[model samples]
Target: MYDEFTIAAYERNGFAVIPALFSAEELEEIERQLEAHLRLDLASAPKGDVVFEADSERSLRCLFRIHERSVFFDQLMRDSRLIQLVRQLFNGADVIADGTMLIDKAPLTTYEFPWHQDNAYQFWNPPDAVAVTLALDDSTAESGAIVCLAGSHRESILPHQPSGVFGASRSLVTPPNADEYPPVTLSLKPGDVSLHHVSTIHRTGPNHTSKHRRNLGFAYHTSRSVCDNAAADQYKRDLEKFLQTQ
Candidate 1:
């Protein structure tokens, strides 16, 4: 559905931004549904699905498996705009929704996400999944916007270790030297979306602005892709042990 230039940018830079992908009305509806979910449904959400700020239990860090919990989010994952883009990204192959999550970076409460790649946690065999992040609020440098290392997805998965952060559990074993890999801050406005490869190296700083930085992440993989169950299970066990000690 996207032009070659747009697709090419994603391939070249490991990430691409689609400006104003969602209309203001759609965003308003999204906010309304999200508010209802938080107020009425969040209390019953499964453990581990909801994560709070490390130091403040009242401050939310993320809400995972949103599509499974909210009908509005389930339908959102099936939207043609998102599905078509994912298909194009996978060379027209049919895809399946991996999961959806809402990341809320509360001002002065959220911790910085260390540099790492998504595949480190997912362990997808083909490593072709794409993460679609829909900006619910303006993301700027001061708001700890996502920053990606250009072309890093072209490399194999890097080593990762426990980060000790609540929501973000793993981090790159060796942080990327900015001189060797220049970072590109993916600043976006409300209604904008960004797509990134599973192997892309990315991280976010803690929000410094008074405003919150919130985004909805929808991940998808080709129908043929499979997860490395053994590795994934091992990672979970390791993460559990790491968290227990904290």
Candidate 2:
């Protein structure tokens, strides 16, 4: 469903936005399913799957692997529209859905996410994964929209350290200081979808507006790609150790 220009933009900038990919009715159903999941499924969710705001008792920060807990989300992972887009991004190669998550930023209480590459957390060999984020609410600069460094995917994975942010634990050790790579703020409306490469350098600011910033993310990798098991295990150990101090 993507045009040549859009594919070229993704290749050149390491990210691209597709406007109004989902209809309003579809979004309504998605919202209903999300609410149901929160009410009926969250209580029994696995440990570390549901994370609350660090300072607030009731505010949620993120829900990891939602596709495994919610049927609608599970089906969404295999939807033709998303599958076709991901396949095209992978140059017609088949892909496997890696994971899904719901990220929520409560109004005025959320913290900023530090700059980092997605592959640092995933540890995928060759790092060919792509993340597709669907905005449930308008994402503006005032609402802490994602900001990406254009063309930064060409760089190798940089050093990362614990960010101390509960939901997002890792951050870049030395963020790029050069001015040549400009930051592109991705301002999106509801029903909009944005895709970015695994190695793209990006971060989001804290929500300053009264409105909540919520988005659903689906990750996919080429079928030929595999996880670096040793590295992934080591990172998990390090992350667990880091979390113990918090």
On TM-score, the candidate that comes out on top is 2
lDDT of 2 by residue, 1-246 (tens): 789888899999999999999999999999998998889767888767788875746788889998887778988877798889989988998889877898898898658898989998897777788999999999999998889899998888899988877788789999776485689999999999999999999999999999899989999999768898998999888877776666
RMSD of each: 1.5, 1.3
By lDDT, the best candidate is 1
Model 1 whole-model lDDT (C-alpha atoms): 0.88
Candidate 1 TM-score, true structure as reference: 0.95
Worst 10-residue lDDT window for candidate 2 reads: 47-56
Pairs with steric clashes in candidate 1: none
**Per-residue lDDT of 135-217 in model 1, one digit per residue for the tens?**
99999888988999998898789899887677887899998877766799999999999999999999999898898899999
Give the Cα lDDT of each candidate.
0.88, 0.87
What residue runs in model 2 are displaced by over 4 Å at the alpha carbon? none
TM-score (all chains, Cα) for each model? 0.95, 0.96
Give per-residue lDDT, candidate 1, residue 208. Answer: 87
- How many steric overlaps does candidate 2 have? 0
Model 1: residue 2 alpha-carbon error in angstroms: 1.3
